[model samples]
Target: MQPDPSSLLQQALRELDYGQQPANLYDPIRYIMSLGGKRLRPLLTLLGGQLFTDELGPLVKPALATEVFHNFTLLHDDLMDQAPLRRGQPTVHEKWNANVAILSGDVMLVRAYELLFENVSLPLLPQVLRRFSQTAAEVCEGQQWDMNFETETTVTIPQYLDMIRLKTAVLLGFALELGATLAGASATDAEHLRQFGTDIGLAFQLRDDLLDVYGDAATFGKRVGGDIISDKKTFLLLTALAQATAAQQATLAQYLGQPILDAEAKVQAVRAIYDELHIRPQTEALINEYFQAALQHLERVAAPAARKQPLHHLALQLMDREN
Candidate 1:
């Protein structure tokens, strides 16, 4: 049976020992890992392995690599975004300097690869490393695309979707596929798991976009309209631009361009236009479409029906049961 995800996360955390040679360099690694999130990606890795094999021991190190790599990206991402807070605490760059954060993040990347190699066989190691390398590069490409969208107001729905796919979905895909590969799952089944993770990631990101505009402030952990205030080209804004009329488009441009307005006013104005264009419903429909597509991939995983149920349940929960 699969270990409880929460316990698995705790156990993985306990096993991490980044060493003490350079306290400054390694402390940040420990600090960031300590400030944990849902640990979903690592859990996916463990789950994927368990679905194919009874023993989960070999999967732990490789699975933890995904989370380590994930945190490494976040360290750099926080620096790039100049994000003041993460998990309601000061970010790596905030607590330490940018140079320290960069160096620490770099080491984390190296460590992530080291961890993945722990239990993987010499022959199969190349396959896992190659795939991990590709996914890591794609994440950087996605970050670039996201930055591009900031100035280029003409970004289309497809373009935004692709950006999210690279930035968020691909890692999630790798998380699931890596476990299956480690467990010696067939190539076809592994591919299905990867596709399943990717599709679920797409829908999960859209849900995040929706929540940014509609989620309660207390629950969201930040201001609900921070994206609108900053003119971040989220799905809601992009969709509104796509479906709005010439007149509606002009009004939107006016609101988006007005940077000096109070935050509430800007959010309210943009959200008013969103409601007018029925952006919420349009986004919800698209999320459901992607969620359903994810299920199709999950169904193709070739695992026993019972083994697949846990992942299936998670996919549904992620998309808000729209599927």
Candidate 2:
């Protein structure tokens, strides 16, 4: 029987080891790792492998590797964004100084590689590492593109979609792909799982975009309408731009990027434009499209109905979230 993800991950985390050579470097690693997250990537990795192997005991190392690398990316991203909080607490850069956070984050990446090196089998190590390396670089590239879009006023919907694909979706894809590969699943089945994860990741990000503006403030964890205040060129904003009348476009240009404006007023005004353009419904349509595409791919995976049920259930839970 498949154990619940939370119990399995908790057990895995307790056993997961890190070096203690430099207290300063390792302290931050411990601090960040202790800050709880969903552990989705690692869970997916294990589940992906389980589609082939009933035991799933041997896949623990690579599953944790995905989680470690995921946290490493989040640590650096928090610094780069100057984010104040992560999981409702001070971010690494905020808690420590930027220099400490930078050094600590670098060590965390090295440690992630170390974990990979020590755990994976000799025969499969090279292929696993190669895929992981590519995913890491693409995540960085996606983050760079997101930063670029912050200042560039004319990002197309297609371009923004591609950015999210690289930034967010690929790792989810790699997580499932790695698990399947380790379990000796055929290349074809692995590819199907990868594509399914990618599509679901896309839908997940778009939901996040929607929530940034419309979510209940307490449930959302950040200020509501954050994307509007920052003018972050999300799917809603990009589509609004496409559908807006010339005068409405002028209104958007007037309110957005004005430093002197009140934050609440600016959010309300931009959201007003969004409502006029029917951006919310349009974005929902697109999100549902991706969600359906994900389900389609999940259907194509060559696993038995019972074996695939857990993944199918997890995908539904993710898609139905309001926060």
Summing lDDT over every window of 10 consecutive residues in candidate 1, give the lowest-scoring window.
314-323
**Total clashing residue pairs per candidate?**
0, 0
In model 2, how large is the Cα lDDT of residue 40? 90
User: For residues 146-262, what per-residue lDDT tens digits would candidate 2 score against the true structure?
Assistant: 999999978999999999999999999999998898888888999988998899899999999988887778677778988888878999988888888999989888877778368
Cand. 1 Cα-lDDT: 0.88
CA lDDT, candidate 1, residue 64: 89
Predictions in order: lDDT: 0.88, 0.85
Tell me model 2's lDDT, rounded to 2 decimals.
Answer: 0.85
Provide TM-scores for the models: 0.96, 0.96
Best lDDT among the predictions, by candidate number: 1
Worst 10 residues of 2 by lDDT: 1-10
Q: Could you tell me the TM-score of candidate 1?
A: 0.96
